[model samples]
Target: MPEKNSSSQLIEPEDALLEAFWTRAKNVAKINPLEVIVGLDSVSALRPSAYSLGDSSEEADRLCKLVMDGTKRATSSWVASYQAEDAPLPEVGELSIICDGSGTPHVLARTRKVTTVAFQEAGPEIAMAEGEGTFAQWKAEHDAFFRRECEELGIAFDPDGQVLTEYFEVLYSH
Candidate 1:
């Protein structure tokens, strides 16, 4: 099957594969366009991006579990890294298919709000939504994460770098 390029990975729609998934997701979500929704689109334009987080399979599993439990609602990334990688940044009203460790789509997420702030500006609100403990811990962990990533990529890590944050809501799960 042919593959389509995405942010930092590949998603092979393979004609009906993604279409079928969208149909199933909509059904599981119980979205009745004629009743509960007014501008619901058809499956003709299935544009959800799929992704799996964490470095290890176990880590991915843990993060997915957090997402399923609604403990994780937001995500953060470095704007410079995204730009360098040519990854698509999260946008409002965009749908994302959150895959498990094995890359199987499980939960569907819809972007609600997006904010960009200096690294030092990510506060308690962001920390709580990330489900990664207190603000101080989140900050320290994030700083270390960005610095490590930058070092690995041979790029400079700016302490006041811009952080692109996405706050999403889970729409469906299967």
Candidate 2:
């Protein structure tokens, strides 16, 4: 059976599909460490680095346009142990296919950098990287989002919680 979309669970393509994509990706670059990320879908694909943003199909479509236009270049995530069940921690130069909320792969990108920082340390630079809003806005919005996530996981929200931040360069539109 397919897995549920809980905070602990990361949605991804099936193993067979993932393997097939990997084979194709390898032809484009030697040693491509391919991954799948939840993205927004529309004209192009707006691939967010994390799934906690409550991305809808229409929302994803808008985000997709931003990424394709080279306006949105980065995404972040709060580390989850469950992800290890599917894939390893991201590494620089790894490739990712941005999928919509429905798990349809839409865009391909290459990881450029990954940084770990405390939740409270998400600064203007990070917010700017997301192209979402100001640092204050990012923190306020993310705090609420993470709060609900913590509740679902039966944990406390640490203002100093650590997050995995990733920067990527878009490589393909489809």
Question: TM-score of model 2 relative to the true fold?
Answer: 0.65
TM-score of each: 0.77, 0.65
Superposed by TM-score, candidate 1 places the C-alpha of residue 21 at a distance from the truth, in angstroms, of 4.0
Candidate 2 per-residue lDDT, tens place, 65-106, comes to 667677778876665422423446777876676655444555
**Candidate 1, 1-174: lDDT as tens digits:** 123243333333343554566778867776554543445554325547777665445556677788889999988888888877777788887888776555666688888999999998777999899897899988987898788777766789999899988999998876
Question: To one decimal, what is the Cα RMSD in angstroms of model 2 from the true structure?
Answer: 8.7
Q: What lDDT does each candidate get?
A: 0.74, 0.61
Estimate the lDDT of model 1.
Answer: 0.74
